[model samples]
Target: MTIIDGKLTKHYARVWDYCHELLRSNPGSTVQVGVTVNPDQTTYFHKMYLCFKAIKEAIGRDASNQVYPIAWAVVDIENKANGKWFLELLTEDLNLLDGGGFTGLLEATKEVLPNVERRQCARHICANFRKTYTGMEFNNMFWAASFSTVESEFLRKMDDIKEVDPNAYENLLARHPHTWYRAFFRTDVACEAVENGIAECFNAIILDARKKPLLAMFEKLGCT
Candidate 1:
C-alpha cells in the first residue's frame, strides 16, 4: 500500500500519482488524463484511458490477424470532452493513419473518429427499435434490413417494414440507412464485422469493477 501524508491510503488515492505508478510498473503503457475547465479557472476531474502494451499487442498489427481488444478506459462521465479525450489518446497510441482501414461504431467513437466509417451495433439497434416497436416480425425485419448484403435485398426488407407499420418504418429510416444497413456499408477495410459484441462483453465483465474506486477499477481491469 502506498503511504499518504501522515496517513494510509484513503478510499480513493490521488489519481495523478497512481497513473505515474502504473506507467512505472508497466513499460510501454499509455495513460491520458483529462480535465474540465470551470469559469473560475479551476479544473474538475474528467476521465482517463490506459492502453497497456499487452492490450496493444493483443490487437496485433493488422485486421487480418488482430483481435479487437484495442483499449479500455475508466471514464468518469461519457460526455463530449471525455469521449474526445479517450479516442484522441487511442488514436495517438495506436498511431493509426488518418485514412487507415478502420471503422468505429456508436456515439463516443463517432465523436472522435470522424473519418472512419461508422456503423451501429446490430443488437443495440434492435434493442432501440424494440423500445418503440415490438413483435417477432419487427425483429426479423430489422435483421433483414441490417444483414442484407445487396441493395435490392435491403430495400425489399425495408419495404416489408413499411408495409407492416409505416410509423416504425419512418422511425427506422430517420436513423439513417447507411449507418446500420450492411448493403450500404463500405468494405474498403474488409473488416466484415457487423456487431460490437466484444465491446459489450467487456461491459459485462467490468460491471462489478466499475463500482470500485478508480485505482481498484484500473487494477481489476488489468488482471486476466
Candidate 2:
C-alpha cells in the first residue's frame, strides 16, 4: 500500500507512475494506492475529487482490471458542531463517489476495484478522550492503556480503574468505544503503522522553524 498527502498532485502522479512501472516490470503482481488527507485542510475535498477523476481517466472505458484507489481523510472531533460539519462533508464526498452525477468514477472503479473503506485516526481518538474526561485520575490510566501494546497489562489496569470508579469506567467504555476500546484493539496494519513519535517529530520541526520569523529565515538563507 502507498500512503501520501492527497494535496500533492505531483507526488500522487509520481506514485501512480511508480505503481504502473512496477506492474509492467512484474506482471501478475497486484498493487494498491492509499491517499491520506487531513480534514482541516480546506483544499483536501477538491483534491480528493481530482484524485477520483484521475483514477477514472486512467482506467478508461473498460475498467475490468483497473487497480483500486482508496482515499482517506482524518478529522479532529473536539468541537461537536465542527465535527458534525466534517462528517457531513465526508458524506457528501462519499455520495459523489457513490454516483452523485459529477462523474461515474466510483462506478468505473467499482467495476474492477472494491469499495473504499473509511477510517478514523487513532490520534483524534486520544484527543477526544482528553476533551471528554479532563483532570481525572482515570484519564491517565485510560490513556496509558489505550496507547500501550500489551493488551493484558492494559486490561489489568482498566480492571483496577473499574474497581475504584465503576461509573466512570462504564460511562467512558460505552460512550467512546471506537476511541478508547476499538483504537486499542483494531488490527489495521496501515493505522497501526502510525506512531505518536512521528507526529511529535513533525511538531518539533514546526516549532524549531517557527523560532525565526519567515522573512528573517528567508533573508538569512540569502533567498531575498
Candidate 3:
C-alpha cells in the first residue's frame, strides 16, 4: 500500500516522516494523516504485510536517481489500533521524540478549523466494519444506521445491529457516530454526503496510472 501524492511518491512511512519534518522545521505548515486501510488483500498476495526489507535491500544496490524509502509492517489485523502501532514505529525511526507532536485528525481539525464541520466517509466506515463483520445483513444495517436522519431512527438501526450481534454493536458503537451519521451533521453545511465517493472515484480512475513509472503515471493521469 503505497500512495502517490502530487510531487511526492512516498510510502506511508515516508509521508509520515515528511509531515513530521515539515511541522518541526516550519510551524506554519499543517499536517494530518487520515488513517484507513483496504479491507481485502490483492489477488497475488493474501498476506497483510509488505516485503519492505527485501525491497530496501534491492534499492540499496540499484543506481537509480530516484530515492524511495520503504517502511513495511506485518499486522495481525487491519484496524485503527494497529495503524497507530505502525505509525509509532515510523515516529521512532524518524526520531520524533517529543511524542505529543503527532495528533489524530479529529483533534487537529478542531484546533485548526474549529468552525468547519467534519464528516466521516461512510464507505470507509463500511470497509473497516467489514473487517470484523460481513454479509448483507450487517452491510444493510450499517448503512441504515449511517443514513438515518433522525436520532430515534439512528437508535433503531443501532438496535438492529445489537440484535444481530452484541459484539458487532459494540464495535460500531466505538466508531464515533456523531461524525458519520446524517442525524448528527450540522444543518448549516447543506451537504448530505455520507461517503467521500468523488475522491474514491478519482482514485479508481487513476488506479492503473498509479502503478506505472513516474513519467508514465503523469502521462496517464494527464490523459485521464
Candidate 4:
C-alpha cells in the first residue's frame, strides 16, 4: 500500500507480491530506513510531504552475467515519516520482526522491532563529530577507530584520537561508538557497513520522482 498527500494510492507491482519471498530468502537482512523530503507535495497536516523508504538486499542480477546482492523490496510511502506510526505500518506489512537497521530510526525500531541490531551510521556520526573537531588528523583517526575490526585496534585508534583531542574522543564516546563501530557489530548478520549507503542510493534513484505531484511520485517510485 502507498499513501500520497494523505490519500491511499493503489498500484499493482510484482515487488509487493514477492516481498515475502524475498525476505524469507534473505533472513536476517539489514533494513535501511530513511526519509526524503518531497518538496513538491504538501497537505494541511504537514508543510512538506515525507517520502519514507525501506530497502533491503537480495540475490539478483543487474546484468545478464552479473549475479550479486542487489537492493530490492523497496518500500516507498508518502506521509509523515517521523514517529512510530509509519514504522509500525511498514513492519506490519513486511513482517520484519527482527533485523538490523540504522540508528536514525532506532526509537521506532525499538517499539516495532525490539530485537533488531541497532547500528549508527559512521558518516552521520562523523558529520556531528566534525562540528567541534576538524582537521585531517582528527578525521583520519575517527574513521580508523570506526573501521577497526578488533577491540584492541579500535582502542588504539581511539587513543590516537584522544592524544590529538580529548574532547573529540569524548564526543565520539558520547555518540555511542558501540552502535557505529565495526568491532561491536554482530557477526550473525554478516554485514560490515558502517554507513547507510543502501538507503541513500535508493533515495537518489527517486530524487527526481519525489519532486513530482503526489500520485505521479507514487507511480514512479512503485515502478522504479
Cα lDDT tens digits, model 3, 14-117, are: 54554466458645433344444456643221112122232322112135533233343434355566555555544444443443332223532343333446
Estimate the TM-score of every prediction: 0.80, 0.33, 0.50, 0.64
lDDT of 4 by residue, 1-224 (tens): 23443333222233243344434655744333333445665521211122223333232224363333333323345334444555554555455655454233344466666777877888888988888788778888888999999899999999888888888888888988888888988887666778876566667777987775544564576577
- Where does the lowest 10-residue lDDT sum fall in candidate 3? 43-52
What is the Cα-based lDDT of residue 114 in candidate 3? 39
Clashing pairs in 4: none
The better candidate by lDDT, 1 or 3, is 1
lDDT for predicted candidate 3 compared with the true structure: 0.59
lDDT of 2 by residue, 86-199 (tens): 333434434444422222122223322233323234455556656755666756776665655666776776787788677656755664444333344445322332123433
Error at 63, model 3, angstroms: 50
Query: Candidate 1 residues 108-220, lDDT tens each?
Result: 56655666787777777789999889889999889988889989998899899999899988988888778777787787866555677666666777787666666776777
User: Which is superior by TM-score, 1 or 2?
Assistant: 1
- Candidate 1: the clashing residue pairs are none
Rank candidates, TM-score, best first.
Answer: 1, 4, 3, 2
Cα RMSDs of all predictions?
A: 4.2, 14.5, 14.8, 9.2
Off by over 4 Å in 1: 1-11, 37-43, 54-68, 106-111
Best by TM-score: 1
Error of 2 at 224 (Å): 19
lDDT: worst 10-residue window of model 1: 1-10
